[model samples]
Target: MNEQSPLIPTLPQGTPPEDLVPIGAPGGLDAAINPLGAELWFLRDRDGGHLLWNGNPDIWSGRAPILFPIVGRLRDDSYRHDGHVYRLPRHGFARHARFTPGAHDDHHALFRLEDNAETRAAYPFAFALTISYAITGNTLTIGAEVANRGDTPMPFSFGFHPALRWPLPQGGLRAAHHILFDRPEAPDIARLDSNGLLARSEPSPLEGQELRLRDALFEQDALIFPEVNSHAFTYTSPGGPAIRLQTENLPDLGIWTKPDADFICIEPWQGHADADDFSGDIFQKPGVIVLPPGEVWKASMSLTHERSA
Candidate 1:
């Protein structure tokens, strides 16, 4: 992947004005990233085929919002920290906060978000979150670093919510697309109740290592896998190019889509939402990572386009 000087790349149609920055591989992938929430707005393949969802307002106006501070939702949209109660909405506020752009070139881009009055009010932590994207060959690598900049330890969660085109750009029926996990999974899947809180764990939905895709699967919302055995999976149809996603330092997975929608979200999460009965301090929440002060926690996920012959 030869690096090129920064230049203005073509923007996809209907792209909103969100200070989006363009980055592309030599002949593989092209992406437009927004500073607001450090979200990825557009992703296209070598032939200019859209590989990402378009953030259509009618269905779901979220292209690829970065989940932070919390992967899912809190019990009452609030948490306890140092005996005081703080409120944070579902998935945290990083998706709605603007990040400062760092060094960026044609093949890579970086954005950083730091603690402020607004964030501290809800999270009560001094921290810095950096998000980076690099495209090489037919693969796009996304990296994130969370640094605890305060005197006390901080507990938080992080996740990636990239919604790829349901049928993909490779050409196949939406129903034909399925996910092939890297290992045989055996644990029951977790579900969300009517309040979006973590509910009971149901039976496994996998047929060995393959999960057949369908609309009815997501009728109740996201299928949360709190204990998954695979670190990678392939989203593909019967033929044509397939999307291969790999994760590092992320333990959970969530597959979600609105019924009859044209996109599917493959989420890799470090933590999950509070359980339906959970009502304790933030540190006691399940799957939450407690970072020591002055330490950094990192996680990454990459997407590779596997072209068909």
Candidate 2:
């Protein structure tokens, strides 16, 4: 394959924003990135509340900022807090809000979001969320920072969802891909129900293989992996460079692909979907984080593409 710049349409200042971009051609890297060619990056705005892509916070990408997915969806966009229920949009309001652009050079850019009246009404907290994207050689580094600005404590979760091109030789319903991890023990897989809620699946070995993606596999929605050992997961084609994702503090990983769809979502999360019998307390939610008054919490992960030996 030729080493060509990813295709993305240029959005001059003041143009209507678009989340998807073409990649993999000349002068393409500067265009907004989409999954049609290779990989696309997504990020959230200053408020960290909007979805930015599909009006859902968990999935986002666009032309100017270089789309990358972030956050997860809360059921009905509602969660219980101290016995009071607060309603938020699908992935909260972070992705839709305009972000303050961070200083950048030629290869990288940074964006930030915060919580205010609009955010407080839905989630009731003041906070800051900063996301940075940097590219060096063939690797991309992504980082996120969250700070609590409320007088009282706050509870929340965070994560990343990236879709990479399946560089296999053939494309069909029976196409297979191999996934390998850096850890010894396989992470616990959480099976999603018909309603998209997650439940624990039977523990299985992390043996490597090229498994076909069939329609039957997605009947359960997504494969959620908890108890991961801050390691990396790699996917490779028969004769292509490996696509690798690494995490440090994140403890959860989700692997999902739409049935008959052209792409797969490799999601790294700090939190997860609501449980089947959830009581609604935000802190009690699985993988939820509790921040003390004026306290701050941070979590991040990175992705890289490289040739296999």
Candidate 3:
């Protein structure tokens, strides 16, 4: 790679030339593409660092790069599609796949992932997934599209996991930060057992207090909330501004932070953690989406930061 070389792979002929510009640093595994935030706005790690969705490769973030957060199978890497079982790396392949930039101007670009042989062995269905990211000023709009490519029916689970930097005021700690979901009622927290399985569910109350990130809190895994009223959520600091994330076509939400870590992950999911008593049928899982042949499924989410009045 040279100073003028592109950071990502070269686009195919007839593809939009403007969309193939260098969005990140040269020769680095990951680059800081967007300048709106201090952190690298997207995640495109090393060659194999990306996730594979049904053989459709996608990238993952090692340093705060925007990437797809394919739930259902983030860690330990495996899932049971139909009555048969298959396995792959964590978070699926879509997160690691090198997407061809589409629908580009100066403010926004679209990245896409499609099905392939490697993905068919595990997922066993043809599908087209497109992610369109539009950046207008400080706001980013993320759009997801899933289309069935096979004649037979296909069932799967998917979600988004964008980790945002928690900006605390001077001399403040993460324990002093608060997160508010846009809903009138409380949420049900999905408990994870020692074996990283969904053990049970409980109520979540956001009473305007600080959130303590500890290992014991994740002992039961992530906090999964289903049947939420509002489509947006906010993370605010007592003495500073806040960031708001909104999503539709997402029936579930996950709030997670590394044990005693500095950042918090506000995840919008269409599916959830593995059940302790799964029947090996993908559709039997909660919040699973089943798409017919030639059918297209779409969902979108956005993130914006603003000062609190």
Encode model 3's per-residue lDDT on 131-196: one tens digit a residue: 666555445666778888899887766677766554332314556566776666454556666655
Model 1 agreement with the true structure over 164-190: per-residue lDDT tens digits: 999888667888889999998866899
In model 3, where is the ten-residue run with the lowest total lDDT?
48-57
Candidate 2 TM-score, true structure as reference: 0.74
Query: lDDT of each prediction vs. the true structure?
Result: 0.89, 0.55, 0.56
Q: Worst lDDT window (10 residues) for model 2?
A: 44-53
As for TM-score, the candidate ahead, 2 or 3, is 2
lDDT of 2 by residue, 203-253 (tens): 543554323444556656776778666368776555544567787677877
Candidate 2 ranges beyond 4 A from true positions: 1-6, 9-76, 168-176, 186-188, 203-215
Query: Model 3 off-target regions past 4 Å?
Result: 1-70, 74-83, 168-172, 208-216
TM-score of 1: 0.95
Which candidate tops lDDT? 1
